[model samples]
Target: MSTHVLFIHGLWIHASAWRPWQDLFEERGYSTSAPGWPGDLETVAATRANPEGLNDVGISQICHHYADIIEGWDEKPLVVGHSFGGLIAQELIANDLVAAAVAIDPAPVKGVKVLPFSQLKSGLPVLGNPANKSRTVALTPKQFKYAFGNAITDEESDALHAAWTIPGPGRPLFEDATANFVRNSPAAVDTHTAVRGPLLLTSGTEDHTVPRSVTLAVAKLYADNTASVTEYHEYEGKGHSLTLDAGWTDVAEDVLAWLAAQGFAPAGAQGAAAAG
Candidate 1:
């Protein structure tokens, strides 16, 4: 049996953006897949052409969708997620679903109370209008630049926007934004539980969408769970685009190294696979 790695994408980014990571993990002998959020189409263009399927979708629905898929799998996967996907990754591990998880620049869960201005601004596109809670929202190039591409050149940011940006359901944003107030909010994760898979939470200091402060706060929330391994890493000059931008491999390589440290060798008796 081989270890499996599941990649989960965040808001405004199509699932296909994980293709590179999937290919790399496969080369290391791990079976992998990047399943889109519920209602995502087969391709970026197709999803953009018709995003109605995701309208009104919320965090719980998205979680259930992935949970169903994981339940069908033969082995618990090592999940790696970015942005909102990072939150989902934590939820999965906290719920005893996946073997372990890597949450990169993940949105703050319920217990995290720090709301940075950059994070607020990044979410305003959806949270600014109450009506957006029940609709799907798309970020403009300018908004994408501020929220995701600030650490890179404008030209590169624009190119990335054109390639991977897509409509994202506003409900997850709304759910997370109001998590601190909502009791039993779907965005809440069982961070206090001391018996779950090892978790690695990463942050890009330049990320506006989910600021480094928020991710660090999340790590603090897990500090009480001494029985489980929870680690944090910071990328000084990266932004939310670190997962898909020009330097994505660096972030992916770090994750590969962390997994090795956690004793998750590449499947099929392969030794720790070198990051290409």
Candidate 2:
């Protein structure tokens, strides 16, 4: 049977944004799926037209949603996630629900203590207002540029915003912002566990949403897990938009190479090992 690869997207971007990735992975002999969060509609326009379904959704709820999907699969799949989905990917892998995971510019989990100013600023759209915890928030073009597209050209940023951006529930941001102070926080990942599947955490150096320092700290938390492989890769000039912008293929290729190194590459495929 072909290996199943599940792609999980972050906030704002629609799940359909993974179409290109799915196509590429399918051509490489892998079965892939990109399912949206609990209340997400099928298309960007449909989700944007009515975002009420995402109101008040939290981190735990999103994690459970994916877990339910994985449980129904015949084999444990490899998961790749971006931003908030990155955090979800870690949560799932830490619990041994998936075969392995790649978290790209993931949101800060519970144990991450370094809160950069850029990360804070990127989160203000949701964290600035206490009421947003129970509401859905949309990012303006300017906000989106700063949070996700700063490393790319303005024209491209604007185009991506129009194409894939959608309303995101504010609850997860609030949950993550306060995770360090809360006991049994949903944002917590068992980084200390040494028996789970291998994990790869990638970050873009110019990313304003989740800075390189933040991802480095996440990697540090897993330092003591000697039994499991926890690798970190950095893309010097990339940003949060690395997954949705024109440079997405570069990131995807690196991920495929990393998977190949871990012996999870698709059958009879080269896994784009050259990219690494």
Candidate 3:
């Protein structure tokens, strides 16, 4: 059977950012798709022209939007998500919608309590403005440099900012920050469930936005799961932009290897490997 892989992009970037990943997975015999959040425009230029489309979009809306897409698939997919997308992967897993999942530098959900100063600083662009809760917010190049490109060179950071940055909904940031205090917050996940499937949580050691401490805490939350597999991996010297960084394929290969070990290797991969 073909392994359907779903790629989920996070805030400040659009579904197009996963194009390279989709190509790589397809080459390995996996069918891939990357879906946009609700109200997302077709292109970055269009998103910039009318940023208001991203306003007031909360975490629940984004999750449900993707959940519907997953439900339409003929088979359960291997879900991979980055940053806020990572949190969404976990939420979908909690709903038993995926065959396996990989959350890379995912944002924190309720009960994850290892926030570092840098993580807080990275989120300040949205969290600092209470008014942003109902508005769309775009990160300044300087802010993007600090949050995502900290581990890369200035030129690379500038290039990435130019190519991938876009406006994002502000409400999800506020919702995640206050999730612990909110009753029945959409950011909540049932980590103890066996139906969550095999979950792999990856952390970039140098990631400022979702630091190692935060990812480690999230991994620990699932430590009590006896019926499902949960594993954690940390990439040395990597940053929040790991998915888009120069070493992105390395991370992707690691995920592929893990899936292979878990008995979910893409259909025809062995034949393709032999042909090569």
lDDT of 1 at 237: 97
Report RMSD (Å) for each prediction in the order shown: 1.6, 1.8, 1.4
Count steric clashes of candidate 3: 0
**For model 2, where is the 10-residue window of minimal lDDT?**
267-276
Supply the TM-score for candidate 3. 0.97
lDDT of 2 by residue, 1-276 (tens): 327899999988899999999998887777899999988999999999999999989999999999999989888899999999999999999998888899999998888889899999999988999999998999999999999999999999999999999999999999999999999899998899648888999999999999999999999999999989999999989999999889999998898878877888776686354442
Q: Which residue pairs does candidate 3 place in steric collision?
A: none
TM-scores for every predicted model:
0.96, 0.97, 0.97
For each candidate in the order shown, give its overall lDDT on alpha carbons: 0.91, 0.92, 0.89
- TM-score of candidate 1 to 2 decimals: 0.96
Residue ranges of candidate 2 with Cα displaced over 4 Å: 271-276
**Stretch of 10 with least lDDT, candidate 1:** 267-276
lDDT of 1 at 233: 98
